[model samples]
Every structure is written in structure tokens, then in C-alpha cells.
Target: GAGVSQTPSNKVTEKGKYVELRCDPISGHTALYWYRQSLGQGPEFLIYFQGTGAADDSGLPNDRFFAVRPEGSVSTLKIQRTERGDSAVYLCASSPGTGVRSGANVLTFGAGSRLTVL
Candidate 1:
């Protein structure tokens, strides 16, 4: 795919279940990000990878959530003990690289993976 790809476009899980979301960034892109969006609200940042390592993960709410970008291309977001409050649309985005401080970098977002916790 020329753009980011998110797997399991939609997922329904019972409370306490564990879920893993996958994302494949555009070829050659070195910057990847994960975000979650609740109804009627903007997406909330989850984590970001500058290459094969995480550049920032402070947006993660707690230890129950984790993400990894091994080899600097494919990434996965893991959620433990899913709760109803965790239900939301998870979005993945990528950029060629973090541009200069001039702010010219633009991110391309995937269609998103919707998760429902019942």
C-alpha cells in the first residue's frame, strides 16, 4: 500500500479481553504515530516512533497500553485488559520523517481501526 495500513478494521471484544492492533506504514517512511479517537472528540496521541525506536510514548494512559515499531516499518499497538472506556477508533499515521523545525512535515493517516468493548 502507498499509504499506512491498519489491520482488523473493526474489532469487537468483551470487557477484560486483550487486543492487538497492527499498522504498516508507507514504504520508506521513518516516522509513525498512533492515536485514539472517542466519539465527538479529536484523536488523542498514543505513541510515536522516529525509526525502530519509540520517540515518545507519554501519551499512553498507563502501563496497560504499549506499542512497538520493529525494523522501523511495521508497528503494533497492544492493549491489555480492555475496558468499555477503551472502545474507540484507533488511527495510524506516517510521515517521510520529522521535517525541519520550519514545520513542513505532514502526516498521512490510515482509515482507522474501530474497536468496541462490550
Candidate 2:
């Protein structure tokens, strides 16, 4: 993809339902990240992947939230037994590499997927 792309720009679901959000990163990028943003708040990092391995998953709220980057290009975020509090925007970002010092890791974000719990 030319830029980061996210699927299902908006989603609405009942509390306790499961949902999956998808991301397609820019071509040849090797670092991917997932973040969550509530209304009026900055994005909160959830997970980061360097290649196929998750380099950072410390920010995930709980086991109910999970993500995977199988080929280092496309990623999926899965939420199980979603709660009303989980309603928010799911953002995906990609970088050329995972080197924090490198400008390539600065992050390019997708428009994000908005999840609504009813």
C-alpha cells in the first residue's frame, strides 16, 4: 500500500461481542503499531511489532485485546468480549524500522477504525 490503510472505518457492536480490525501498512515497512484513542485524548500505544514478533505489547488493557503482524506488513487487532468502555478509535502506524533513534520510526498513522459499543 502507498500509505497505512485501515478497514471498517466505523464499527458498532453490542457489549460482549467480538470484533476484528485490520491494518495494511506501507510497502517495505518493517515496524507496525496499534494504538487506541478515546474522545478528546491522545492516542495510547497498545502494541508494537518488529517484523513478525511483538516488540512491545505492554499497553494492551487486558487479554481480551490482541494483535498480530504476520508478514510485517499487514496486521490485525482482535478484541474478545468487548465492553462499552472499549469503544474508541483503533489506529495503526508503520515505520521503516524499529530503531527508535531513526527518523523512519517516527510513525505514519492510518485514519483509524472507530469502534462503538452499544
What's the lDDT for candidate 1?
0.93
Per-residue lDDT over 35-104 for candidate 1, one digit per residue giving the tens place of the 0 to 100 score: 9999999999999999999989999999989998878999999999999999999999998887576147
Assess candidate 2 and give its lDDT. Answer: 0.93
All candidates' TM-scores? 0.96, 0.95
For candidate 1, the clash count comes to 0
Worst 10 residues of 2 by lDDT: 98-107
Model 1 quality (TM-score): 0.96
Q: How many clashes in each structure?
A: 0, 0
Clashes of 2: 0
lDDT, candidate 2, residue 74?
88
Error of 1 at 60 (Å): 0.2
Off by over 4 Å in 1: none
Q: Candidate 2: where is the Cα deviation over 4 Å? A: none
